[model samples]
Target chain A: MKPAIKRIIFIVILVGLWELGSRLGLWTELILPSPTSVFTALYHGFADKTLIWDLIASFRRLAIGLTLALIIGTSIGILIAKSKTADDTIGSMLLALQSVPSIVWLPLAIMWFGLNDKAVIFVVILGGTFVMALNIRTGIKNVSPLYIRAAQTMGSKGIDLFIRVIFPASIPYVVTGSRLAWAFAWRALMAGELLSTGPGLGYTLSYASDFGNMSLVIGVIIIIGIIGSIVDQLIFQRIEKSVANRWGL
Target chain B: MFISINQLNKQFLDKNDQPTTVLKDIELDIEKGEFVSILGPSGCGKSTLLSIVAGLTSATNGEILVEDKKITKPGKDRGMVFQEAALFPWINVIENVMFPLKKEMSKQEATAQAKKYLQMVQLSNYLEHYPHELSGGMQQRVSIARALAMDPEILLMDEPFGALDEQTRTRLHGQLEEIWIKTKKTVLFVTHSISESIKLSDRIIVMGTRPGTILTDIKVDIPRPRREHKEDMLELEEHVMSYLKKEIDKVVSEELNHETSH
Candidate 1:
């Protein structure tokens, strides 16, 4: 079977099994909401504009958080890549810091920014920045030394060298770093929204669960996964494919 | 002298901190618009010597002079082409050829100069093609155009055709010879192939390995359109090969000793 067909079949089987189990009363409705009820909840949520509002709110945070992460991460990465002393000292610190989960920053972010947008954004930054910096550093370091030498001989120097040669040559790696950073930012936003009280999918999830609206909870979860997949497919994957084509990757 | 190397020596510390000399007491004077090839065995530091002359690498004890000025760093006076084309993959053929020219000339002038060189290399059809889209031979030709577009006083090529097949190599040799004659730029070429050296060079500088030093500097007196001088070319090839064989044997024996001892 074609891969797309296989995927559709698998999803169908999964939904079929869930529907069968619900019909058989194998589990409580609260534990596992029926797919039909979840769909109904989704339709009602869309009609009331609650789901769209929540999605917009989450996307707004993601846009801001991601922009900040990219700037800070790329700068730190370039600094680390260019300086041997910085690579040796700060590189090790970053490696250690990256091991801590994004959720681990929740307490500190709350303490620093007191349960506001700042707290959520702070957590998102902590999640994405290190990963981006580390990947960018690797990308810059891995740029072919031959390219540098060739460009140098051609009268390229200093800032010109970095901009014309280093930056373009490291495109594949930098794009990959951005993709990973976006993923990290998205996850951090969801985790932060759960605790900080925001108008987002995470906020809706927490609210629905608290009210024992299992169908709404399930509907929101599906929407989150769908949104993530859509962005990856439409944006990040498109960029990666074009880069691969250009570089003959 | 248009370009001169004086008492040049290069040494490096091995992993154990022992001194390892790569090139020693290299001295040569190159006239303006001369085609010179440095021929040697694999480890003979031929490329190193070329790099030092190009000011990409520094000599341990001496200095190089171009037009009576010391070469402390790479300048527009010298253009270099490596074994690999090393063209910027991000840019198209015309852009890459135009890159070095951009600093000195306006965009239109640079593009026109680039177009002329590309046409000289017979790559006018590929002016918009990316480096990756071109074959190895085509890529090397683009690099030649890029170097020529700079209008440097000297061209330093370190085995520029080393990676291509025999057919492509021969064709490039013809193209390079034609370019050299037309441009009349001083060139310092490095290669291991005696035939390649004999075909294009006005003078061949043969070198030996293990503390690389000049073995002989042979002048190719066998006039231009050398296709008519096949017999003379063969005799020079044999003479160059005779000296190169001793160096190759020494390297082989050393490698065998290393393996046996290990």
Candidate 2:
């Protein structure tokens, strides 16, 4: 069977098993909602337009945070890659900072920016930027020295060298870094929304849990996974594949 | 003299901070439009000499001058072709050829110039092809076209055909010879192949290993269309190989000694 079809079948089997377990009372509906109940909740969310608003709100936060992270992360990465002193000083500090879980920044972000969009965005940027910077640094480092030498001989120097040779060659790594940054930003956004007052999926999920709306909570969780997968499969994965194809990697 | 190297020496500091000499007291005078081959075994520093001349590396001591002007860094006047084609994988063949020209010419002119060189290298049909899509020989040809498109006064090739198969190498030899004849650029080719040196070079500088220095410089007086003069070429090849064999043995013995010491 084709891999796509096989994957669909696997998902169907999982849903079927879940539905059967719920029907058999293996788990109470309060604890584990049936697939049908989850779907009904999902349908009602769309009918009421609340789910769309939540999605828009969550995506808005992600876009602002991710853009900021990419800008800061890429610059830091290039700086670390270009200078030995920066690599030793700022680079080591970043490595140490990366070890701290991004969630740990939530309290600090809240304290600094308070319970507003700024707080969530700050947390998202904090979560995403370090991993992106590290990946971009690695990408720059791993570019073959031969390419640099070749470019130099072709009359490229300084900024020309970076733009023409180093940047293009390191694109695959940068794309990979973006994907990881998105994942981190997504996780951080959720944590932020859960704690702060917001109209995002995380906020709705916490509300549902508090009100004992099990199906709504389950539906929101599925939406998070779906959105993450959609971005991965549709955008980043395609970019990676095209790059690999072009470079014959 | 067009390109002159006087009392050139290069050394490197090993991990132990001991100075290891790679080239010593190298002197050469190359005329305008001359095709010179630096022939030597592995570790003979022939490539290093070529790199220094190309202004890609600086000699620890001594100087190189082109038309009496000192060379300190890589410039458009001197172009280098590496053993590995080193073509940009992200760009197409025509773009790779046009890369050096972009700074000097408009996009249209660069395209036209690149096309002319690609045609000269018989790769006009593969203009849009990416580097990885082409065969190794074809890729090297693109690199040659790239270098040629620069229209440099000197072309420094460090074993450009070294990685190709025998058949590809032989065919490229003919193409390279023809290009040399047509362009009349002062060519400095580094190679280990004796026949390739005799087949193309106006002068072959045989080098010795272990603090690399020239052993002899033999001028090839054999006329062009060398394929018609196989017997004469073979005789010259034998003469070059005889000198090279001694250097090869010295390298082998050095390797064996190092291994035993280890």
Candidate 3:
């Protein structure tokens, strides 16, 4: 068999063992629901259609947060990289901001914006922007000085130089930063949902746990895992490999 | 005249904040279409001198004149070919060559001119190839072609073939000679290799390190298309090597004596 197929089979076997263990009463149903029971709950999740709405709402907010983070973060990153004064003053502030956990800001966001989309958006931006800016600054700063000199010799100056040279060179790092920020934002989203109690996967998971619906909680957990893996495998991982492998990053 | 460097000197403050001179009082005059090589050992400030001519680095003192005007910055008039063949990796061979032309020409015109220059280098077939895809020698050729495409009056080469293997270097030396003969641009080449300096230069400037100064400035007193393995070439090569050997020995012993005394 192919190695990839073998790996898949190995994972399936481990999951099968967990299911068997749960069914054989190694733990209570409350502790470890069987795979079949989880699947059943997931099916009921689809039947309700509220779960879909929750997913769409969360994904929409995520898109806004990520978009805002990209524009603001990259701009700041470029500024900090280009100017010594900017780097000294703002770069230190960015470093300090990055060290603070996103969860710590939830109450502040809620206080400022209330329990709506803005609060979640605020959390996502706070969680993501520091990583993006810091990585991008580092990336732009690391561009070979010789490369810049060569470009300058060719009469490339001002905006044209940045567009043709600096932007392309720094893209691999920006992509990497976005990928890292995605994982951070994902965690932040869950924490925010749990506390804020809106209609999202995290909120639904919390609601299920509050109601003692272990099966529903298990179903939400599976959904989150599947979606996270899909995003990593299909989106960010492909971008990283394309840059580092094919483009000689 | 093409360019003139009048008493050029470059200095930097050392760690102890003492002024340390790299090149000292360089005075050189180049007529139009002359090929001169600035030959030196490492740390002799040959590259720094070239950079000063190219206006990529400040001279720290004195003036460089291109066509009787002071060279305060890089312009289209003076093109440069670096040691590492600093081609833009993002652009293909043709685009790399056309980079300088973009400021003055339309995109289509720039591309046609780029192709023409590539053809001059016999690299028309490799127009689509990226810098990394080309061999080291080929990449350096692309750098030359890129500079040539600018239609500059002078070519400042800082050890352009210094990184290639023996066979590739020899072949490129011949090719460069042919190109220089055909184009007739004022050229200033920096090289550590004695034979390379002898082969390509109309005049050779041997610089000594540690507050670098011109040790010798000798005209080749030989014709172009000089071969490497010839008997006559070997005689002249030996003369240069022996001369450099004595100077190097003097330098080494002085440093050793200084060390022992300290």
Native interface contact recovery, all models: 0.56, 0.58, 0.34
Please, what are the lDDT tens digits per residue for candidate 3 over residues A188-228?
Answer: 78778878867888899999999988988988988888888
Q: Write the per-residue lDDT of candidate 1 for residues A165-216, one digit (tens) a residue.
A: 9989889888888999999999999999988786888999999999999999
Query: Over the true interface residues, superposed, what is the Cα RMSD of model 2?
Result: 1.2
Residue A67 accuracy (lDDT) in model 3: 82
By TM-score, the candidates rank as 2, 1, 3
lDDT of 1 by residue, B1-262 (tens): 9988888999988999998999999889999999999999898899889888877788888888899999888877788999999998889999999989878999999999999999999999998899889999999999988888989989999999999999999999999999999999999999999999999999999999998999989999999889889999999989989999999999999999999999
Could you give candidate 1's fraction of true interface contacts?
A: 0.56
Error of 3 at B173 (Å): 1.8
**Per-residue lDDT value at B125 in model 3:** 98
Query: In model 2 chain A, where is the ten-residue run with the lowest total lDDT?
Result: A101-110
lDDT of each: 0.91, 0.92, 0.85
**Candidate 1: pairs in clash:** none
Predicted model with the maximum lDDT: 2
Q: Could you report the DockQ of all the candidates, in the order they appear? A: 0.67, 0.69, 0.54
User: Which residue pairs in model 3 clash with each other?
Assistant: none
User: Model 2: which residue pairs collide?
Assistant: none
Off by over 4 Å in 2: none
Alpha carbon lDDT at B66, candidate 2: 97
